[model samples]
Target: MRTARRWRHYLKPLVFALCLAPALWLAAGVRWPAWVDLGANPVEKIQHTLGLWALRLLLATLAITPLRQLTGQVEWLAYRRMLGLFAFFHVAAHLLFYVVVDQQFAWPILLEDVAERPFITVGFAAFLLLLPLAATSTAAAQRRLGRRWLALHRLIYPAALLGCVHFWWQVKADIREPAAYAAVAAILLGWRLYRRRPRPAVTGAAPTPARGSSRD
Candidate 1:
């Protein structure tokens, strides 16, 4: 009991700090860009890391549901929002790097990429979907929106599917990593569908109506 109590006390802050760790390390890497050798193509490396971590965190957010189901721990839901927000933060970083470092905010290049590059187009769409979800994750928004919040959040399904497609399309030759991400996404999505599937009705005979009551 004492151990569980202590764990509950520290869990939120620990998870919060861990979520921020990647951003902090990425910032340090930027400061020591030359000192830290990411790869032959540093820009690609940085962008890949940002996008990969964002996708990974997004998967983690989805995994919480299955994890809770298996473990019967409802508290797991508490961290889903944090994971999603961190995913969004990493995605924002990914875009900022592409815009500021790669494209240099060139309007022509940005427009051309979005229009011509399927990967960039779907990635941008995924980010656009995330914008509203991240915006309305607040308790106040939940209260104000009520059931509408859940409907709005369902946008994540398409957003994540697009994110997987974007990653798969961006890969040049080696597709194993992207394939794995896609597989994870498929499993998560399938799990949700499986859980929501309608059950077969009971096979028992219909019950008799009361003498005074007529069936509606």
Candidate 2:
């Protein structure tokens, strides 16, 4: 277990860097657009990339519990909170980029988009769901909230679902990518439901048939 603990220490930082890599790459592309081709439409590319990473990381965060259960390794949980927070970070960045750059801080236009666009509506709702999860992610908040924390965190299910819908609805065509993400989200959620299903009680081997007293 010394080895396990040591690996945990090293793994967190490595995973943190890996989580940050996409954002860093996007930042570099923004900084040096001439060197890095963000396609003809850099802003759109960056926005899509950020939103994509947000969904990916959110799914990854949800996978932690199932992964731990399947593998029986508690270590997989070590990164769950970090992964969740990064998911929120990317999502928040995605929204901010849209509001600041894409929409130029135009609240009227932003509200119009959210009001008129189904994709934007769902994406904004997903962001709102994630907001509280990110806010109360700390150990202190977890302890203070107790069971309510678990209940509140359950919002992630809908958030992830909404995010997938947002992606699918936004896509003009070629829905393969969004479909893949939706499939993964569905599997993860299905596994959670399967795991949580009530099991049949053993009843101590049927009480040895009670010496054949009227019933088998």
Give the number of the best model, judged by TM-score.
2
lDDT of candidate 1 over 1-216, digit per residue (tens) = 345445866897898898888777767777887776665787777888899888998888888777766665556666778888898898889998999999999989999999999999999999999999899978888778877787898788888888999999998999999999999999998988886678777789554222111111
The 10-residue segment of model 1 with minimum total lDDT is: 207-216
| Inter-residue clash pairs, candidate 2 | none
The 0-to-1 C-alpha lDDT of every candidate, in the order given, reads: 0.82, 0.88
Which tens-of-lDDT digit does each residue in 65-159 have in candidate 2? Answer: 88767765566777889999999999999999999999999999999999999999999999999999999988888878877888898999999
For model 2, the run of ten residues with the poorest summed lDDT:
207-216
Backbone clashes, each candidate: 0, 0
In model 1, the number of clashes is 0
* Best candidate according to lDDT: 2
* Stretches of model 2 off by over 4 angstroms after superposition: 203-216
